[model samples]
Target: MQPDWALLLLVANVSTLTVCMVLKLPQIITVIAAKNARGLSVRSLLLELTGFLVFLTYQTYYEYPLITYLEYPVLIVQDAILLMCVLFYNGNIGTALPYTVLFILCWRLITIHRLIIDLAMNLSTFISALSKFAQLQSLWKTCDSGQVSALTWGFAIYTICARIFTTLMTTQDTAVLFRYAVIGVLNTWVFATIIYYRKAGKRKD
Candidate 1:
C-alpha cells in the first residue's frame, strides 16, 4: 500500500474507534437524567470494564501501538461511571464507592507483573465475549431494547469492520483480524436485538 493510503487507513481506524468510545455518552446521559437504570445491566457493564482494563494493561505491558488501544481507558471510565450510576439508583451507594475503588486498585496492582498481565489478557478476552452474551440475555429477559444504546453497538460494528480491513491491508495479523471479526459478529447480534425489541415494544403500544 502507498504511504498515504496507509496513513489514511490508520486515521480512519483511529477515528472510528474514538467515535465508538464516545458513543456510550448518550446512554450515560440518559441514565443520569433519569436517575434510574431500568433497562441497564450491571453485569454487562462490569464485563465491559474488565475487558477494557485488561486490554489496556496488556498493551501497556507489551508496548503495543497506543493509538490502537487508547480508547480502552475511555471505555473503562465510561463503563465505571455507568455502573456507579446503576448502583446508586438501586440504592447500593454504600457498595458503589468501595467496589469502584477496589476495581481500579485491582487493575492497577495487576499491571505490575507481565506473567499476570498475559494471563489476564487472555481471561479478559474470554470475559468480554461472555459479557456480550450476558447483555444479550439481559435484553431477552427484560425484552427492553431501549436500555442499551443501539448507536454504541452500531459504532462498535463499524469500528471492528474498519479494523479488520485495516489490519488486512497493513499488518495481516491473523490474531487481530480474528478477534475483531468475532467482536463484529457479536456486536451485530446485539445491534439486531436492539432493533428487534424496539420494534416489538412499539407494536405493543
Candidate 2:
C-alpha cells in the first residue's frame, strides 16, 4: 500500500530541519575558531536573516501543515541564533543599527496580516538568493587562494543535497519552485568551486 502523503510530507519537513541545522555547524565553528569575523561577510549573514524571516512568515500565513509549520519557525529561530553568533564574532553587539530595528519591525509585522506575511516571504526569498550569490563569490575567491574553509564547503554540499530533495518532492509549478531555483544556483556555484579548486590548485589574483 502507498504511504500517506501527509506522512511523507511530515518526514520531509523533519529532514529539511535536520539538514538546515547540520549545515549551520560550519558557521558555528567559524565563529568559535576565528574569535572574530575578520574574514567573514556580514552581508551574507544578513541575507540569510531575510530569507529565514520570509520563510517563517510564509509558512505561518498559509498555516501550512503540522511539521512544515513547526519546521519553518524553528529554522528562522536557528538562523537568528546563528546570525547573532556572527554578530558577536564581528564585535557588533549593542549597536543601534537601523537594520536591526527594521528586522524587528518586519518580524513583528509579518505576524499581523496574511498579505504582509506574503510580502515578507517574497522579500526574504530575494534577499536570501542575493546573500547566497555573495557567499558563492566569496567561496570562489577563498578557493582560488587556497584559503577556503572546509567546514563551509561541507555545509554547502549538504545544503545542495537538501535542495535537490526539496525540489524533487515539492509539486511542480508551486511558488516554492522559485525558492528552489535560487537554491539550485547556490548548489551549482559551490559544487563548481569545489571541483575547480581541487583540480586547478590555487589561482593567483
Candidate 3:
C-alpha cells in the first residue's frame, strides 16, 4: 500500500474501532430502559454475532493486517452483551447457554480448513444480511421501534463505511469488501426502519 493509503487505512481502522467501542451501548441502554425487547430480533443479533466471529477468524487465518479487522473483537463483545440483554429482557436468558456453546464450536471448526473459512466468509454475508432482514421483519411486525436504538444502527453504518474503505486500501479481498458493502446497505435499511417506526410511534402517542 502507498504511504498515503496506509495512513488513511490506519485512520479508518482507528476511527472504526473508536465507534465500535460504544456502538451497542445505546441499544443496551434502550433495552434496559424499556425493559423490553419487543421490536428487537434475537435471531438478527445471533447471526450478526456469528458473522463477526467467522469474519474475524477468516481475516486472521489469511494473516490479514490487524488494523483491517481489529474492530471485530470489540464488536463481538458488544454484540454478545447486547444479545444477553435482549434475551434477558425477553425472558429467554437460558437459551444463551446453547447459543454460546454452538458459537464456540463453530469458531473452532471454521479455521480447520481453508475452504471452510472461505465458504463461511461468503455465507456469513448472507447470514448477516438475513440478520438485518430479520430485524426489519420484526420492526415491520411490531410497528414500533421499542428498544431498538437509532443511534446504535447509525453507528453501525459509520463502521461499515470505514471498513469498506480500509478493506479497499488493505486486503482488498472481494469477500470482505462485498460483506461490508452489503451489510452497509442492510444496516442502513435497518436503521431507517427503526427511525420510521420510532417517529410513527411518537406521532401516535
Across residues 64-179, which tens digit of lDDT does each residue of candidate 3 receive? 98978788899899899989999998889999999999999999998889999999999999999999999999998888888888999999999999988987776789988899
For residues 3-92, could you state the per-residue lDDT of candidate 1 as single tens digits?
A: 898788888767866786786888788878877777677787788787777777776677766666667677777787778788888787
The candidate that wins on TM-score is 3
Q: What's the lDDT for candidate 3? A: 0.90
Candidate closest to the true structure, highest lDDT? 3
lDDT of 2 by residue, 1-205 (tens): 1468556655666676676666566656656676755434567767877777777567656665444435456555656666677677667765526767988887887888877776776776678778877766765656541333455555555554554454455533255667766766775675576557656663332
- Which runs of model 3 end up more than 4 angstroms from their true locations? 1-4
Residue pairs with backbone overlap in model 1: none
Sort by lDDT, top down from the best: 3, 1, 2
Q: Which candidate would rank higher by lDDT, 1 or 2?
A: 1
Q: What is the alpha-carbon lDDT for the whole of candidate 2?
A: 0.62
Error (Å) of candidate 3 at residue 73 is 0.8
In order of appearance, the predictions have TM-scores of 0.87, 0.72, 0.96
Name the candidate, 1 or 3, with the larger lDDT value.
3
Candidate 2 has its poorest 10 consecutive residues by lDDT at: 143-152
